[model samples]
Structures are given as C-alpha cells and as structure tokens.
Target: MHTTTEESVRGCPDCGSEIRVHSRFSAWCAACDWNVDPAPPEERPGRLARAQRAQARRHGEKLLTELTAGGTLRPRRDASSVLAYALALAVHAVTLAVAGAGIGFLIRGWGGFGMVPGTLLLALAWSLRPRLTRLPTDVPVLRRADAPELFTLVDQVAVVVGTRGVDAIAVDSSINASVATYGIGGRRLLTLGLPLWEILTPQQRIALLGHELGHYSNGDTRHGQVVATAYRSLVTWEYFFHPYSDVTLLTMTVNVFYALPRWILLGLLLLLDRLTLRGAQRSEYLADRMAARAGSTEAAAELFDWLLVSESAEVTLMREANGSALRGRGGSGRDDERIDGLWERLAADLRSVPEHERERQRRASIRRGHSVDSTHPPTWLRQTALRIGPPVPPAVVSETGRELRIGAELAGVRKTVARRILHDGYGN
Candidate 1:
C-alpha cells in the first residue's frame, strides 16, 4: 500500500497527496490533481515569506490533528466561529433595519434632501442581499415506486444517521452529491449525482448519502446560508460605494464620506468571512466522520479517491457525446441508452490506462490545496480523520441483494433524470 505523507514534505497543497516531481522546479498532486511550479529563481518567495508560510501550515496541521485526535468526528462550536456568525447576522440585520427605517421616514416626507441619502442607503442594502443564484434543478424527483430499492437504501442510511426520511431525492448528470433545505420547515431536497453514483459501489453510495445527510444533522446547510446572506448583504453596497453615482452632487458628496468606512467595514466582514468559512470546513469533517460511523469508513475514503478518476472521465464523455450530436450522429434508438453507453466507455477507457498515466491524470484534477475559504477540507485530511477509530467491519450485502433490491429498478429513474438534464442544458 502507498503510505501517506505529512504536508511538510513534498505533497500537493490542495489535497495533500504525495507530489510527483515534474522537474527541478515543478510538481503535481496525485490526489486532487493540483499543479505546482515554482516561479523563476529570481521571482521565488523571499526566505522570510517562505518561512512564514511554512510555519503557518505547521500551525494549521497541528490544529487539525488536535481537534480530530479521538477520530470520532463531531461538530465543534468554537467561540470565534460563533462570534463571527453572530456578528455577520448582526451586521446584516442592522443594515436592513437602518435602511428600512430611513426609507419609512422618507415615505412620510420626514426629510427633503435627506431622502436622497436614504434612497442611496436602501439601494445599497438591497443590492447586497444574498441572491438566489442557484436556479432550481429540473431533474425528475425519484419516488419510492420509481426506484424502490434505491429509496430503501436511502431510508436505511437515514435511520442509521438518526435523521428523518428525505422529502425528495433527485439524480443528476454531474459528478457530485449534495443536499439542500428549502421552502417551509422540514422540506429538504437531496440530490444524488448519477456520475458519482455510477462509479461508487453500493456501500460507497451509502457512505456518500450519509455524508450529505450529516450536513443536515449538523444543521450546516441552513446555518451556512444564514451566515452567507450576511456577507452578501455587505457586498451589495460595492456598486454604490464606488466613485461614480447617478445621485445628486450633494448626495454624492455625502456618499463620499462612506468610502473609507465602506472599505473598513468590508475588511472586517471579510475577516469574519474567513473565520466562518473555517467553521464550514470543520462542518465537512464532522459530516465525513458521521458517514464513516454510519456507513463505512473505507468506502467513504474510496468515494473521494474514485472521484478523482470519475469526474474527469465524465467531462470527457460529455464533451465527446455533445460533439458527436453536433455532427448529426443521432443516437441509435430508444434502446441505445446513449449517455449511459458513453459514460461506460469513458470509465472503461480510464480504467484501462496504465497506473502511471492515471497518476498523472489525477494530479491534473487539482485546483489548489486547502484554503480558509473552502467549505470542504482537503481530501487527505478527510481520509485521515475517518480512519481514527478501531477498524469497523464493512457491510457485505451481496450483488444479488443489490440487484434484486435497487439496481434493476433504477433504469427508468435514470433515464428520466438524464432526459431532464439534456432538456435543461440543450433544449433538445
């Protein structure tokens, strides 16, 4: 087995996998596929800058090791994190309250020229409000009868994780798994990306689902959105705070007074944002731990590792398939299963590559290492966290069981989801 290494050594900063040295000055990460190349010798960081960064990494590594020492992953309520969130909420609430009051005063003709300032402030507040940028998914929701076996597995995992059943479940063409809570209380939507599902065995699928549910169990989804809304509200004033404005010169001059304070407020909000994001990353670790405990630790790690391969292969398939369609090469017939066939071929192609070649591809997938702003921790950190306790025996449901229960029933649901994805993307 390949051994894991410390981040202090030659490891990819993004996912912490051992880096393959490409030359004297360049390297790549095998786990997340992040590329790293040193600047020209004259342009490299100074000794002090390098030392400071090294010390900072060591400090971060030390903190994670301590927090996760026992390996029974649990959500931590850090004082700094709580304070940051509280402050974010307070900031946004104050902004809305002030702007609303000002607008109300203007409505009543409480001030003449003052209404201009009120208009500007209220506009700024409205602009900064968190936008619902993520459009609703058009994929078909899977019902129990639609995929009885798969729904059974979801129910089983939900019980194990001590949560109520999902209100709705969906399948998508992307290689990701996510859950969101929306509408009135208790309404939740759990999305299972088919690309990720296809590459994962049934056990890993269970772990993956458990992880998504854990986000709910930990209340990360709703609380995260709450905190994010605060930052977005603050960001909205950016357009108004700039040098130009359509308002009267008097109002413009008054608004000029907000320039420095605007940047200062933004700075503080950004600092809080960093702390809040760190808390979010911790939340991911907690979810990963829950998935390991409720499902299978081994499978959880494998799910992330396999994503390195499957995600890239998925893109390749989509690109080629879309290209083929452009050439007027329509799919054979209703029985052809074009998307599924294309994915299978792509997956097979990836599997057939030499180990060395696979490693290179894996490294290419990386964007960068862990950052304070990322909601998820590095993949290696997650793997290490999940492996903390005594080994748990993995579940051993046979292929026959899986096939009779869920596998045979998924085709119809899968086709509907794929059709929706195609319609939404290509209008075909």
Candidate 2:
C-alpha cells in the first residue's frame, strides 16, 4: 500500500490528509468518509483463483496422444478445442455488436426501454473487453549467446519433441517452465524457471522443454490463447454486471426488467466457459504426457512432486535468507557462491515431512481428479496416464552431458536467478 503525505494528486483535497492507496485500482481518505473506490466499484468501468489452474489447463490430449491412446505419439485435433475457439470468437463478436447497436439505440432513446438493453449491451461489451496486460518487471530475457549451453539444450529438446522452434527464451523466477505465443502469426516465446533448472536432472529438463514446445507443435497454443483470453473476459463481465443499481422508481423498474436478460447472459457465458476449461484440461494432460515421452514419465512425475515441494521450500528459504540479511547475518554476495541448488535444498526439506503425511499427500494427489479451472490434470492422474500405455522410448538427448559440461556457468546463472527472485519477488 502506498500512502501519500503531501498535497499531491493522490492526497485528500478536503482534509489535506494522506490518501491510502490500498491497491493499484483503489485508494481512500482515512480522515473522512471519502471512499476512492465506489460502493459498487464503478470500475464496471474496471477489473482477476487458481491454485493450480495453470497446471490444470496447460495439458491437452494432443501432445500425449500416443501415450494416452494406442497410436504413434502425434498431435490430434480436438473437437472441444475447435468449439472453444469458435465460442470465444462468437462471444467477442456478439458482445461488441450488441454494445455498438445497444449504445446507439439508448443514446437516441434515453430514459426509456432502449436504455435497458443498451446499457446492458454496453456493459457486456465492456465486460468482454480484455482488461489485463502482462507486464515484465523482473524476469530477464536470455539470448542464445547469454546461455548457449541452455539454448543448445532447448534445441535438443525441440528436436526430440519435433516442435516448431521458439523465437526467444526467458529465464523467469518461477518454479515452473512455460511457453507463450503471441499475435495471429504465433511468434513463440519460452520461459524456463531458474528454480526448476537448478535441480532437475538433464532428462527432466528435456521433459520440461518438450512439454512446453509441444503446445506449439500441436497447434493447441493458438486456440488455447483465445480461450484463455476469453475466460479472463468472463471474469471482467461478471464484475461489470453485478446486480446493483440505483433504487429509484424509474431505476427500480429498469432493474426489474434487467434481471431476466442479465441472468440469461450469465447462464450462456458460464456454459461456454465450461467448454473452454474442459479443452484446456485435456491440453494440460497431453502436454504432461508429451514431456513424459520426451524424457521419462518417471522424471516428469517426479518433477511435479518436486514442484509442489519446491514452491514451499523456495518461499521458506527466501524468507529465511531475507530475515538473515535484515539482521545483518548475510546478504547479496555473502551466499552468492552457495545458493545454487534450490531443488536439492527443497528435496532435503521434503524429507523432513513425516512419512505418514507424505503418504497422505500421495493418496490425496491420486484422489484429485480433473479440475474445471485448472490447466493440468491431477498429479496422480498424470502419473497414471503415462503408465497405462506402453511408454515411448526415451529420446536419447545426450545433450544433458554436454550441457553439464558448462556447469560452472550454469551455477552462476542459477545464483543470479535466485538473487533476483529473492530480492524482487515475482512481479505481477
């Protein structure tokens, strides 16, 4: 939270007090009843759950087609994905046209029935509009020259996965490896998490790369991007369309009539959203399977478990290290040479969990099923999916040995990544 202390734009005009900026979208005066945020948040004029929603949705069936069913590993078109794409497109079209037509009509016939549909349509369109943009703050981009060993490893994984090559590679502070594609032309980008790279064996690293690249190869990336954007719009629409209005005689009547169509729009949008999530879930499973095939299912599965452990261990270590620095016990260069293997530390921390607790978590992982909003299948399900079919022979991407030859450089890279993560935290 940022608090203003001067008579600036952010300070309170009436009271001359500092305004408390609770968040980017809201602020308030502490001395009076001046709420910078609306009671109903007029930002209908505005604005974001996922525990593992990304993981749940990231896997699709195409990448792991051979492993999931009896066939050679290859990408297959998903009917649901097509439907999701179509629906997302249809949603944007209808919302925009409705907004234009409705607003034009309402403006011509203000304070009448036209106002009802017009306001609603405009709101819907506003809701459907994309409200979020990813801003890169801390994650650093890596050129081929910056990390030739890493880029070479990626090339090997790409060959093994048989995917179109990515245009750029970024080293992020996250513990998960991910890929992003932009524009209709599908300019591709890959993000490799320093945390994941810090501990994963060469085979596991290949698996990660293969899974991310598989999204591009399967053509799911393009469609998935549409659905993902549409899903966020759904959230925005809901906010704008919340059932609140002025309670006057005329407005009460308008509100009464507005109820039916609003609910109808809500129902329609929600149903379409289900299809989007379902397709994404399939994609996640497929991506997971692809990674497994590229490396080994065992390594892929272990990676997931390690991810769960890593998230916790990483936070703990960062906190402890920060606290230590605050107390003048250590910082920056103090442990620069000593903090590379976050995954190894994470593994050691996992061992501290009681055996029974570990057993319980394993059971829980298996019991977890497909999540409607998650991108990846449950860890247990991913493991099970790989085992049911004859596993693809692991691609002998012996590049790991070659990659490891640059271990000193890699270690320095890891230390830099860790420091940035700890110092800056993951920027939004």
Candidate 3:
C-alpha cells in the first residue's frame, strides 16, 4: 500500500538510511527510528503510577508463564480474592459506622452547636455513599427495538460466551468499547465507539463485542459492584483529606492533622489494588479466550492488531478534523459538507497500512511494554497467548446482510458524532 516514489523516498536525517513516506504515518528511518513516534514522549509518571505499572507488569508476566505451561485458566477464590472482598466489606462497614455516628450526633445535639458537626458528618457519609454506574446522558442509547440487528448479533455473542445479553447499546465518538452494569436493576449496557466500529471487519466487530461482553462472565474483580464502589469511596476520602500546599503556619498545622488519615486511606487503596491485580489480569486473559471462542482465533488476533493501530487512528481523526476546520475557515468547503465521508476516509486510511509498518508497530509495542491499560497484559503477550492456546472455531458468525442492517441502524448517530467532532475538535 505504501508505494515509494522518488518524491516519497529520502535519506533519513539521522542515520542516512532510506525512508519511505506513508500517507497516514510519519516517514521515519527503519534502522534508526528518526521520527517513529512523532509525538514527544509523555512525561514520566508520578511515583505511585510507576509503582502500579511495575506491579501490573510483574503480575501479568506470572500469569502468562502459568498459562503458557498449560495451566487451567479459571476464576478461583484464592486468598487475594477473599481478602479483596473482605476489604470491600470493611470499606462499606466504615461508611455505615460514620453514618451511625452522624445520626447519634444529630439525636444528642437536637438543635444545639452539635448539630453543625452532625450535619457535616452526615454530608461526608453521603459523599462517600456507594454509587451505581449510570448511563451517560451525553451519548445516544439504542434499544433492541431501535437496532434489532445489532442487538441480535450481541445476543448471539452473549450466548456463545455464556452471559446474559445486554439490555441496551450506547454509541459514542470514542476509539474504544466497553460493557458496564448500570442502575439499581443492574442492566447491562454495551458502549460502542463508532470510530473503532467503522474500521473493523464484521467478524472483527464480533470479536470486539465478544471481548467486551466477556467481561461480564470473566470474574473481573474491578468490575464487581462492591470493589468498584469501595475504590470510589477511598478516592473520595483521599481527595477530602489531601494536604494543602499553602505555606502558612495554620495551613501547615491543618496538613499535619490531615496527614495520618490520608496516609491510612492511601494504604487501603493500594492494598485493595494489589489484592485485585492478579484477578483483574486473569480476567482480561479469560476475556481474550472468550473472544477467540466467539469470533475465531484469527479474528480475535486481528482485533488485537487493530488495537495496536488505534493511536494512529486517533491521530488521523484529529488531523481530519483540523483539515476540515481549515477548509471551512478558508471558504473552500461548505460548513455542512466539511465532515462528509469522514468515517469512510478513516477506514480507507487504516486499511491501507502496509504489513511492514504494522509489524514495526507491533515491535514498538513490545519494546515499550504497551497495553490497553494498566489492567491488561502487554499486547504482544496477549497475541502470543492466543497463538499458544488451543485453537477455537468461531461460535458466533456475522452475516453480510445483517452487518449492513446494523450499519444502517447506526447511520444517524454517525452523522451526529461526526458533526460533534468537527465542531468541538477531536478528543473533546
């Protein structure tokens, strides 16, 4: 796909090696990587972030070793899992204790000065209360009646993965997809990012669905309501008790008083994170297995390849938005038509990426220990595990006509998302 014409080929500035221009990528030296990453490397993370990453990597490596040795992969109630649940229960108990204390203060005060502290304590308890995941109001929600074809495909995948089907689907402009439980009834919602969805082949799309829906059955500790809400409460406590940096003596004294509780909360948060880390990592691998089972090993592996290119996809989208804006400002294009065929152009660009460049990106990911997030193993490791694991035939298949219907269902929201990106710029 990347043809090297005289105009597109030049010697690298740093190593003097031949570099070929790519339409959607930076032309960098293959030998020296003169400009491979174009964007400046991100600033080093803080100490805590670094520590967390290190722990995740270590845990991921251990899991990978176990799996590669033919160890069974299933969620089990190990000591860490038990401890994690106990800690979550402890967190909830603390909140209840605080609420009881607040009630006692209110009863004892009965309209005296004590009422002030009672009210404050009650407010703190309210702030720390467990919260259910809520459906985002900003995105479009598509029910089964509205997008029967899409829901049907999702339902098929769910059956293959042995989980209950989602109650609704949410569409957004993000480059990722996820599943979450929302409301008191715990309804399942699948959020599809149109940018990612449009670029995927129908089978790849099924793989994406399989991966997300797989989370529901994979025993991800972080996704469970109790642990999730406990984490949130700890975050709230950390924020409230965070030390002020002001230099005044009064502020210093207040910080000293806040320091002990803040440290204690931080310790609990880290301990919970540590306890759940192994289970969280295992769940991701299990989800990947579910994806392979539902969509075939080939499609699942290709899905990870697509993920490796998502950063480039994001950069391309931003560039497209900027170009459209400049064209509008220069009167070279009508405002209404600025974003026309945007998704088409993006898919075309990504599909045209040459194999060599893809390999280069894969190698880059390995060198950098890149992952989807802290919870996931490195992309290379996941890909490797899929290859080493038992071969899986697709349990859920995509039909061409159904794929078309699903696209048709998403058409209107695609336009709205395009306009939002053009007006607000990418990554808003």
Model 3, range 1-428, lDDT digits (tens) per residue?
22232337789999899888765556777888776666544634755556567777888889889878988788666899889999999999999999998889989986697788888889999999999999889889999999998888999999998897999889998989999999999999999999999899988888888889999998888889999999999999999998887789999999999999988988898899899998888888888888998998999999888888998788778987887667665453665555667788788878877775787687677767778876578888888888885688888888889988988988888888888887778988
Please provide TM-scores, in order, for all candidate models, with all chains considered together.
0.70, 0.66, 0.91
Model 3's C-alpha root-mean-square deviation from the true structure amounts to 3.0
Q: lDDT of candidate 2 vs native? A: 0.59
After the best TM-score superposition of candidate 3, give how far the Cα of residue 25 lies from its true spot, in angstroms. Answer: 3.5
Regarding TM-score, does 1 or 3 come out ahead? Answer: 3
Number of the top candidate by lDDT? 3
Q: How does each model score on lDDT?
A: 0.60, 0.59, 0.84
Counting clashing residue pairs in each candidate, in order, gives: 9, 19, 0
List, residue by residue over 1-428, the lDDT tens digit for candidate 2.
11222222467777877754422223445465354323331111211124234334344333345455665434555675677778777767766787788779788886587888887777767767744334244567666667677667677777776776666677776667778865566567788877667667777777787788777666563345666677676556555556656678877776776678667666655556455555555565667767877887777766666654453455655754565356552655655533554445544554454433343344444433423224455565566666775566667454646876656545655666666644444332
The prediction achieving the highest TM-score against the true structure is 3
After superposition, which runs of candidate 1 have C-alpha atoms over 4 Å from their true positions?
1-60, 67-72, 110-137, 143-146, 219-225, 238-262, 329-337, 358-373, 395-399, 402-409, 416-428
Decreasing lDDT order of the candidates: 3, 1, 2
